[model samples]
Target: MSAEIWTGVRERVLALAESPGVEKVFGFPYGGTPLEDPLTEEELADLERYCGVRLPDEYRDFLLHVGAGGAGPTYGVFPVRRDADGAWQWHGDGGDMTLPKRLAEPFRQHVNPEELDALLADQPDEEAYEDIDDYDTANDAWEERLFATLWSDDHTVGAICLCHLGCAQRQWLVVSGPERGRMWDDARCDYVDLEPLGVTFAQWYLNWLTEAEKTAGTVSPSETR
Candidate 1:
């Protein structure tokens, strides 16, 4: 993730975005316009301060050197956005994932299904409820909390949606904690599991680009898994 490596990544990504064949494959409209410029240092700083954490080094290099958005990968890399409340969030629409407050915390590398089971253990099982309606009411509340914990923004929490892989799938970059600088493929739609890709942002970006170069238009969301 050296600056030199990122400089090379920036050039290759820029080249790919500008390539005519890429346009034919991904079909993302650029309106025959050029890519945007790198984000200002001040802008990056303000984002970090608002999020209460520094971005991973490779990603920081990317936004500072590479274009802020509009290039690379399947659906193209998404730009960072701030809402009126100054909350840092990304709404890819292709896949909607939150940028959580715990993004500043060290990320969790893996999620344990057993942990969720433990949470359910805190509540009485359906058998514990004599009345079916009562059981439904109690379980609904617990189920809501269960889903929230599963998707929380701490360790094992998703950081950012780096790109939309299409078909309601996404490639996420880990920003907080143990997985802090790695890439993950979220391919739950095909009954496939969430899979890890490269360890850093640079590697992940290059891997996607390389895939596209080798076989244009063959790239799909499931490929990342």
Candidate 2:
């Protein structure tokens, strides 16, 4: 689907989530779209067959609830609503769900920019080793280390899935961990470091979505399903 379609779906989903009777909402930055074919049992089976990976139960339930919407190629969905107490609720079909332990922990601690800088600066200057692929090469050792550190300490950060976009030279961070995930380009990165936007995951998602809308323009209602 086009960018316009995803925007409209996102707005609708957010509205539903904030409406009464809704508890909470969640979404992904990328993967599938509202315009794409609704996920079916056969499709799920086919995906597993082709991908050779068994999706986690929580993720499966998430897909069943919110098919796909947002900026990325495939994403989760949710509706935003207010609770009786006047607090906001991120309501979705899937009830309280837990993310994998491996993916949680980073959000508990602040991302240490000093540590990341030190790690990145200490890397040895050398050619790529055959044993380690490009991602594992010393050049990216610091980034991986930072990500691993965040992943191990906080469960919230772990929920945000990481994916490389475009070519090696130009890539972006896609944060799809908790409520209303979105793709974060370089600008969003700035916001994460400066603003008090909740947890790292929430800040990242909101920053990315806000920037994406500015860059891509708003989606019209007619484009939504």
Candidate 3:
């Protein structure tokens, strides 16, 4: 069933690639409609072993059947590659956030609203500081501390940063706990909490593909010529 689903997906991707003026689509400069090669079973096994957890079923199947990653939602999926020493790692902007060692742990979904509110409320007030230089120093320090707390890895355990959406935005795929197999929007870089997209890997990817095609259709045919 997974293979069949991937086949249909590949077909859609191909169609999208063949669309007129595909080069003008958003994120085309980065991905160019090319998918990386699929991973072998041995490679997939090694990746799972290294992470100490089995990947979600649909994603695992995608790595096995479809290309490992490429030309996906937004800027495209981050591609996993092996080094000269045969160590596997995902490569792309913001990919480092996916801690493989923590993949087996349950994703921590509980964010303390009170704590977050308090942190925001603690922002340094420029009006309170009489000296301009002193206000700058205090503001910078406050921002540093606030960002550190909000971007802590404790909030994203058991997940992988799947793709970057530019402007410091990204998405994650949970591999363990109740949210396993679902996608989450990572807007923490914008000081927002992560929100579950409420869609599985396949659904998320396919939806993007559909939207991409629709975007392509909106281009005037004369423009391509």
Alpha-carbon runs more than 4 Å astray in model 2: 1-106, 126-158, 162-164, 167-225
lDDT of 1 at 91: 48
TM-scores for every candidate against the unseen true structure:
0.68, 0.30, 0.87
lDDT accuracy of residue 82 in candidate 1? 63
Give Cα distance to truth, residue 207, candidate 2, Å.
12
Candidates' RMSD to native: 6.6, 14.2, 4.4
Score residue 212 of candidate 3 by CA lDDT. Answer: 79
**Backbone collision tally, model 1:** 5
As a whole number from 0 to 100, the lDDT of residue 4 in candidate 1 is 60
Taken over the whole model, the C-alpha lDDT of each candidate is 0.65, 0.36, 0.81
The TM-score obtained by model 2 is: 0.30
* 48-152: candidate 2 lDDT, tens digit per residue: 443233444433333334342233221333322334654322233221222322332322334576865675566655554555465366667665665564434
Q: Clash totals for all models, in order?
A: 5, 25, 0
Candidate 1, 1-225: lDDT as tens digits:
455655555555555555656645452435643345777898789888877788888888888887666566667777776679876665465324655565676655445667655775777588888999999998888867665655444434537776777787778888886777788887644424457785688886667566765555433332445
Reference-based lDDT, residue 105, model 3: 94
Question: lDDT score of model 2?
Answer: 0.36
Write the residue-wise lDDT of candidate 3 on 58-130 in tens digits: 9988888777888888888888877788766778888888888889999966567787778889998999999
Model 3 stretches astray by more than 4 angstroms: 27-33, 218-225
